[model samples]
Target: MTEPSSTPHATAPGASASSQTAASQSAADETPASQADFRASARRTFAIEEAAIAALESHLDDDFDRACQLMLATKGRVIVTGMGKSGHVASKIAATLASTGTPAFFVHPGEASHGDLGMITPADVVLALSNSGETAEVTALLPLLKRMGTPLVSMTGKPGSTLARDAEAHLDTSVAQEACPLNLAPTASTTAALVMGDALAVALLEARGFTAEEFALSHPGGSLGRRLLLRVQDVMHHGDALPRVALGSPLRDALLEITRQGMGFTCVIDDDDHLVGVYTDGDLRRTLDQHGDLRALKVDDVMTRGGKTVRASMLAAEAVRIMEENRISVLVVCDEDEHPIGAIHMHGLLASGVI
Candidate 1:
């Protein structure tokens, strides 16, 4: 999980600490009759920003389609480059692209000028981000990037700026004005850029028909990957570690097997090694309530017949779901003939990061 850090500079109206200062200043600068003026100013900024983003919906034209096609055809990763705040958004965009299907990585424009440009190659596509379309570090590398025959896709606010004009395709992320009360900081423009990046990534992801399993491949270190990739067989107890009792075994012997395996249940199989039934703690409790001698009864008489089972190849997440739907804690893994192969408990799912 990301560390919980306060949004020191976030412009979220009443949700960010920075807005407190803006609110206090607004209160002091306005009179009773000028309340409407303050509201009108703030409302206008929001309206302008909204209109700017609305404009982008129509601007997602053939250029956007060409950019997606270029990215999909790449034999190498997409190298996202930008300066300042655009660099932060660029890093997130790269991560989103990588997780969705298009492999990508971020290379800071300043770092590129210093020596990191070696990360780019002829097979790679360079995605340059600049709100004003005039960032110095970004513009300086355009000629060199173009010379290498690397296709350029620029996301910028100004369509006529050098970065946009020089790119093979440009995505417009322009905003009418900043959401900043001073109308100077990057607020609306940054949000617009971030949204555009998400739109592009998701569009490509859909076009590629990216699956959840494919997304998990790119995030093998995370919990989602563990849930999707880990199978029931990988976390199940096997051999003597499983609690099992032959048919006609005494209930006491079945209870002993459960205690020995520490799985809270025992499988009862016939002479042929096919599952006959299962004896859980709940079954034991109900059996004991019948006033019969615990040691006198056989597992075949007390076990729950044809209990719930799962296949060894099923995903751990699916196993968790099946267990949940049945209100059970463990499932018997079975083979084609309904013979017990392995057993898994809820705790095993948690241990395997499938919870």
Candidate 2:
């Protein structure tokens, strides 16, 4: 028998390669469109959330004022409570309120029912958060809170919800819709609640006349606290560490004192030990340019008279402000009688983290 003729399936070598090339081309064509769709979705989400937050400005009405007033007048702590995502936001709000001089703390709604309710007292004000206003754990405490005579402030998306109706003051955090594409996840709604909480905290802060110094006291471990709370006396070199020279002391001797103390300047004092002037490296340069003999000049002659001085009780921040405004680095810390008791340099302030 003759050999069978070869079929096209066995004869065509490029057919399999062509099929694979077509498949890869199809996948490559779909990828860019998929990426574009993701970008469009992200933009839409952001726009929706932005509009949601902007709409909140119109909701700031008398209810907001009443909420602020209640918090401001509360003698005891503001008890913040929520469930799920709302609970996380509640904890942050409580921290902001407490740090800004309004006494507040978070108590989980579920925990509240299990004996943590004892944390609530008649004097304390309850700030409850719920997006739906129907959270079972949160709503369960409303009756008990009311029975205890505790003032209830509710933040909810539904104005008609049970929590809102029972609250002494209700803040409407209702959003048009969530940023979630499914409209199920909490996004815009949570952002709105956070912003509203910030508004309340700031309003109360201003109403109470809370100062930066008070804020620093609450945040003692932070850099802001060091800048606001550190005093000149706290960072200044005192006694033997302070570079000092008597009046009519040689300019060279003053320079030696500056070098020995490593403060870049020396305090020139009169016979009574009161600060008369300051001799600094800048003065030394000027003296060197004006005269030929460093031994012939006196510290008082070349020293800048009546140098900028600060009291020991003055805030380090204020001293730094004065230093920047005057364009000088060294500050003579003086007592009530204008006697130089301490010396502070920019380096000292920077080293102590008060700058």
TM-score winner: 2
lDDT (0 to 1) per candidate: 0.90, 0.92
Which residue segments of model 1 deviate by more than 4 Å?
1-51
State which candidate has the highest lDDT: 2
Which digits, one per residue and each the tens of the lDDT, describe model 2 over residues 205-279?
A: 999999998999999989999988899999999989999999998887998998998888999999999999999
Native-referenced Cα lDDT, model 2: 0.92
Per-residue lDDT, model 2, residue 314, is 94
What residue pairs are clashing in model 1?
Answer: none
lDDT of 1: 0.90
lDDT by residue for model 1 over 1-355, one digit each (tens)? Answer: 9987767545464565567788888887785765567778778777877876787797787889889989999999899988899999999999999899999999989888889999999999999999989999999998889789999999999999999999989998887678887878888888888889999899999999999999888888899899889999999998878889999998889988999889999999998999988999999899989855776788888799999999999998999999999999999999999989999999988987889
Clashing pairs in 2: none
- Compute each candidate's TM-score over C-alphas: 0.85, 0.85
Candidate 1 steric clashes: 0
